[model samples]
Target: MNFRLFSQLSSYHADIKRLIKIALPILLAQIAQNSMGLVDTIMAGRVSATDMAAISVGASIWLPLVLFGHGLLLALPPTVSYLNGSGQQHRIAHQIRQGIWIALASCIPLGILIYYSDFALRFMQMEPHMAHIAQDYLHAMLWGLPAYLLLMNFRCLNDGIAKTKPAMVITFLGLMLNIPLNYIFIYGKLGIPAFGAVGCGIATAIVNWSMCLMMIGYSYFNRQERKLQVFSQIIEKPNAATLKKLLQLGLPIAIALCCEVALFAITALLLSPLGANIVASHQIALNTSSLIFMFPMSIGMATTILVGQALGAGAPEKAKKLSYAALLLGLTLTVVTAFITIFYRYQIAAIFVTDEIVIGMAATLLFLAAIYQFSDTVQVVVGGVLRGYKDTKVILYITLFSYWVIGIPLGYVLARTDLLMPSIGAQGFWLAFVVSLTFAAVLLFYRMRKTQSLSDDVLMARLEKLK
Candidate 1:
């Protein structure tokens, strides 16, 4: 019995090491991607609290739109993962061509929506000054939409085939450019006119285009990409069946992403009535949490690719073990992160604003955030693994129940004088976040377990038959 236990432990450790090898580049890529937004927030915050609030509101609008597009384009990676696993190198270029077409198709409508976001902000009834700041930021951000979407498709394709290093390098290069670009645009340095938030948008657009071009150039010249034939096949026309398959896989992810984002967006909307101070504080906490979240989020993405490729290779047991290994790693990392947030809550809060009330409120929310990290880590990683299994419909239901059925209502009651508890305001919202994330974690884990039990060969056979 002792020998068996030791052997099992050794096996588990080996699996974890393998998982880390796959997950690290993905984690770094996510960190770089998230750092761009964090830089924008910090730069905007330094300009003024109102500038921070404006960016927050604009982000509340912009992030969901961008994430929605990203979710739809997410289909590319899993498709590429499967094809790569099956050793269909020639088919990859065709899929990439189709992905680009789909990305462009999706980008056009989203660009139009972003272009009209200023008009939409008018309906939100924010204070006039805040509204103007938000409008400026949104308008500037609009130009990056197409470029960003195209880059997302490229990143997804690269990541799907387990070539995450290219995506990471491109993202890191973009982050390097983003800081100086933000400084130039936000502060109007180097004898340029001060653009403030508007400049942020322009810098972001430039970075987006730059990243896309760089990825394209890298893929063209890289020996690995050449060996993989990622650009060798010439697709002369759109494949309707392939496009439909991509949408079928991607749309649920988009809805799932939108549902979670909509929950936070609504939270922002609800907090707005409390005062700019509260809203500003919430944004601070939100932005901080978002930056920290990239760690697990990257792990989740890696989990999807690893599990999906394993499934494609007809290795159900391997997929299951990989998912569990990734979850364990994510949980461990989040626990360490939670400790940091708990101990440094006040210090982190102070970075966002000078206002005492905002600082205090943000500190309180950070404590709640610390408590939910484990749950958030679980939900995100498990959901990613499930996405790899192509089991997203249940996730849509899970998010709906957890976020709206439980989280939002509890928040409403706690935040206002609408229930038994005293008005806890935004802190109340954080409590609801903890509850919702916990519920989501439990449900997603259950779904992942259910998915892992199925035979990968059967699933792939079914998919092939459909094809």
Candidate 2:
């Protein structure tokens, strides 16, 4: 064996270990967050399908609404990591302060949207009882929106600085709180009247606030935070420039994310008119894919911090190595997941429902999902690195071109028309998804290769101009 090649291989293995070290906690945190959703759905279903529909409807209503705000905050981790790596940790306090302001400002529009959630349901022409429940549930959940947004900033601060374990612990804590509170409120533990699905919303709100308050306590007293003075100006007046910068950086990220989410959502809706079994199959496959996707997403998140820190420390070459290794890890895990999805698709579908037709369709969709896993992994991991690089607007542009301009149209044609090929239903759409994700991966990574080699000075200048 060549000595240099052996040494390089050993170094590569070490990078993978370091990548997993950071990502494992983030993966757990993301899973815990996902579990919160599952808990709500299962608990609500125990009440009635009507109750389940209410909460599901409420979730669908709010999910897109919150994306822009969340996206805005997504920029925080990398930006903070930049300061952290540069030894300018004192500046993070101001970032946190401005993030709070951004959070509060974001809440107002979201609060009003949730308050008028009735209009959304009514517009959909939903069943009256379900609509009322959904509206009320949304209203109840609104109480916690402030808490969720505030917590997100604090949480991102931790993520930015490579202190990821607290986020994992806090989310697990939220999960623990959710189940019991859900039981009590859902079943009327004391004098409180049972609000059914509304009770679930109430419980989630409580958990949201609890998590936020706990994070606050954690941040204030956490020795590192004190050293960095993250909470030093907890009540600083919101700076207009800072707030605008957050929005400018965040909105594109949000839009790009929403584009992908909307693609899936619209595909489901489009698939709905096909048949119940088709829709059910698509959903099962989608849900499973979503769960598996957390792995790469978590890896990407950790990559962002690692890359941002390297860049901030003025080590562009280190940033490049981190990004490359993280992408390799993402691709490797995706390949493993794809094989698992292929081998166990039928069994996975069996876990969801007992209907034979639904099972068959779901298994097939899972196969298609497996096929696209490679492309999906690339897009997500690359997107993460771009976020860390503070080159987020390009993400929005790339997603729009790939998803809307290319993927959606082709999927529509293949699903409904013989313009290019025979109509193939949901499977056809999934094929288009593969193409679009491939396109995004190719284009986005091309951009990365070009930008990744720039010295920290040049990249920092570009990042500063993003404001």
* Lowest lDDT block of 10, candidate 2: 458-467
TM-score, cand. 1: 0.91
Stretches of candidate 2 off by over 4 Å are 455-457, 464-467
How much RMSD separates candidate 2 from the native structure? Answer: 1.5
Model 2, 1-467: lDDT tens per residue? 69998987687788788889889999999999889989998988998999998887888878887776788899898889988998888888888888988888889988998898887688889899999989989988999999999999999899889999998999999999999999888878878888899999999999999999999889889988888786655489878877777777788987876666778878988888899888899899999999999999998899889888877887778787888888889988988999999999999999999999999989998998998889888888888888778888888999999999999999999987899888989888888988998999999999888788676678778866643
C-alpha lDDT values of all predictions: 0.83, 0.87
**How many Å off is the CA of 452 in candidate 1?**
1.9
lDDT of 1 at 72: 88
Model 2: lDDT of residue 429 = 89
Model 1 pairs in collision: none
The number of the candidate with the highest TM-score is 2
In order of listing, the candidates' clash counts read: 0, 0
The per-residue C-alpha lDDT of model 1 at residue 258 equals 80
